[model samples]
Target: MDFLNYAFMQRALVSALLVGITAPAVGIYLVQRRQALMGDGIGHVAMTGVGLGFLLSTSPVWMATAVAVLGSVLMELIRWYGKTRGDIALAMLFYGGMAGGVMLINLAGGSNANLSSYLFGSLSTVSQPEMTAICVLAAFVLLVTLGLRRQLFAVSQDEEFARVTGLPVRALNLLTAVTAAVTVTVAMRVVGLLLVSALMVVPVAAAQQLSRSFTATFAIAVAIGVTVTVSGTITSYYQYVPPGATIVLLTIGAFLVLTALATPLARRRARAAAAARPAGDPAECSIPATRGATDEVGV
Candidate 1:
């Protein structure tokens, strides 16, 4: 109730909600594909975009979005051409982006920018224009993600099989990379560059650990992402801490809890399932371990 009284807090809450929803939705794909930390690489690349924006005296959010999206596409193009290890590509992008951003910021004489705010988010720093950008950008991310769900799922589940089945695997990868870039930038608003990957990865990781079904995993991941983000934002509003770091801590905590309970949860589920089955009817009572995972992880 007290939080609702303040305009900034309201804005922060709205921004948190929007980012919370979209970031982890994209994360579900990344996690299933074992590319959960891809956001970290893209976040680094986005800083160059931020630096470029300052140099051009334009809106940093849009500039960062454009650059990050381009960087993501370039990454896909690299994969298509280089056939190098994904980790190697991300490693190069990570270092290059950091160096480029530093050089550009120095070149533009924009050192006055509060770099910490971008590295670790500050809810207080969100302006009306930035909020509007977040809204529009998040909407675009969600729409595209939802629209391309089938192709994205097929590619993530198994590009080789998808290609064999006549799906445009390369084109789908490019589209996914672009969408993931948008999501990384959106998450950057709520969690900042350093921790945005956590927001994208942790919730999905937790959900996957706990649920065998991709549907359940997706649903639970969204719930955890939204709940943790909103709670962290509210707490930060009262505590005067950085909202991004606080939200990240919440995500980390959730991930740890889920991890700790995963084995026990699996055992319990197994027991319950066993009890539900007739002693002589193993065929009727057995649940396939790969049921929902087949589509998500290509199991």
Candidate 2:
């Protein structure tokens, strides 16, 4: 209880809550779409925004938000342009953004004040204003995700099918990119630009192994994120470890344990299905079928 009384602790907790909710909510969709790396790309783009903010002596969060949004949109456009090889497009954007950010930081005389914090994360420095911004962003992200859940899910499953079915695939893809940008911006403070990808990807990855339903997977992912945030903060406070690293490590550990637990069960299910197949079934054995009115097939 006394720990809650501290301003820094309270700020950290609020930041954690906001980040945990936003990241996992957005991440479930990212993971489904196989665009998990996109989060890391946007985070790098956000560093450019932070650097610009530093150069202009303005609010880094706002700058990061704007840059992240632009970057997200650009990524979607690139993905569309490189439709057949979107992964290459994404990698190009990620590396280009990272290089641009570094250049901006260097050009700005490299003030280490907020840069390092953004690089490695510093929960101890979270301020009231930043916490408020995180809360607002989190609420907005949740609302948008919920409102577009169906469209997002459809597009994620099959964009071509969705387009053929008259769904607004382009608009949905843009909306998802925007939502991802906002999520990355909100999470940047908690995990930093360097490691924010872990926060976005790890929990969801772990949850997917344990959950069979979409809703169940989303819920478990959020739970895992929140747990990592809270536990990481506490560990950082007592053990003097870096918060971002701690959170990432905890997330990785959870993923490993969950994967280990799921593997045997998954294997058993596979074995059972294999055993259930009818013996001597030509279809099961991949044998060619005989033509109509042809001789009886002999194995």
Candidate 3:
């Protein structure tokens, strides 16, 4: 209880909660669409922006946010350009962004700027203002995700169908990309650029294994994300491990357990349903009758 009185702890908790909610909310769609690696690319871009901020003596958050958004737009543009060759484009963007970030960091003489904080994460550095900013951003993200849920769902499930249905597929894709950028930027505070993408992906992956519906999957993912954040933060505080690594490990562990437990049950249920169907329904009987008629006609 005494630990809760510390301002740093409080801020860390608030930031974690905000990040836990928003990251997984956006991540569910990303995971379904096979764009999980996109977050990692954007996070690296945000890291480059952080270096830029240091070079300019400005707020790292602002710079990182702007860079991440731009990176997202760039990713969407590349995807559009590649069209049928999107995977190659995404790979190019990821490696390109990573190289750019490393170069910028080295050029800025930020070698002593505790870059590791943005790599593995450090909860001790979370401040009050950052927490407030994270809360506001989280709220905005939540509203946007909920407001555009239908379009996002359509695009995630079948982008071609979404295009056919006149859903502004391009615009929606850009929006989702921008959302991923912001999510990565904000998550950097908690998990750092290197590991923030994991926070966006692992929880949703774990929940997907256990959940039967999209909504249920999202709810469970958020729950798992929050639990991992809180538990990891606390353990890291006590054990002196990196919070980001701890959180990521916890998420992975949960995912493995969920996958192992759910696979057998899902298969069993499917087998049972298959067995329960009537063996000689009208449709099945008609198939043989039709075949018999064809055979007689051959005579």
Best-fitting candidate, measured by lDDT?
2
On a 0 to 100 scale, what is the lDDT of residue 269 in model 3? 86
Among all windows of 10 consecutive residues in model 1, the one with the lowest summed lDDT is: 290-299
Give the C-alpha miss distance for residue 95 in model 1, angstroms.
1.2
- lDDT tens string, model 3, 37-142? 7788888778778777777777777788888898899888987897888777777766776676667767777774557777666677887666776777778778
How many pairs of residues collide in each model?
0, 0, 0
Deviation of model 3 at 231, angstroms: 1.2
TM per prediction: 0.88, 0.87, 0.88
Order the numbered candidates by lDDT, best leading: 2, 1, 3
Number of clashing residue pairs, candidate 1: 0
lDDT of 2 by residue, 160-194 (tens): 89999899899889989998899888888888888
User: Which is better, 1 or 2, measured by TM-score?
Assistant: 1
TM-score of 3: 0.88
Q: Return whichever of 1 and 2 wins on lDDT.
A: 2
After superposition, the stretches of candidate 2 with alpha carbons farther than 4 Å from their true spots are 83-92, 267-299
> Candidate 1's C-alpha lDDT?
0.83
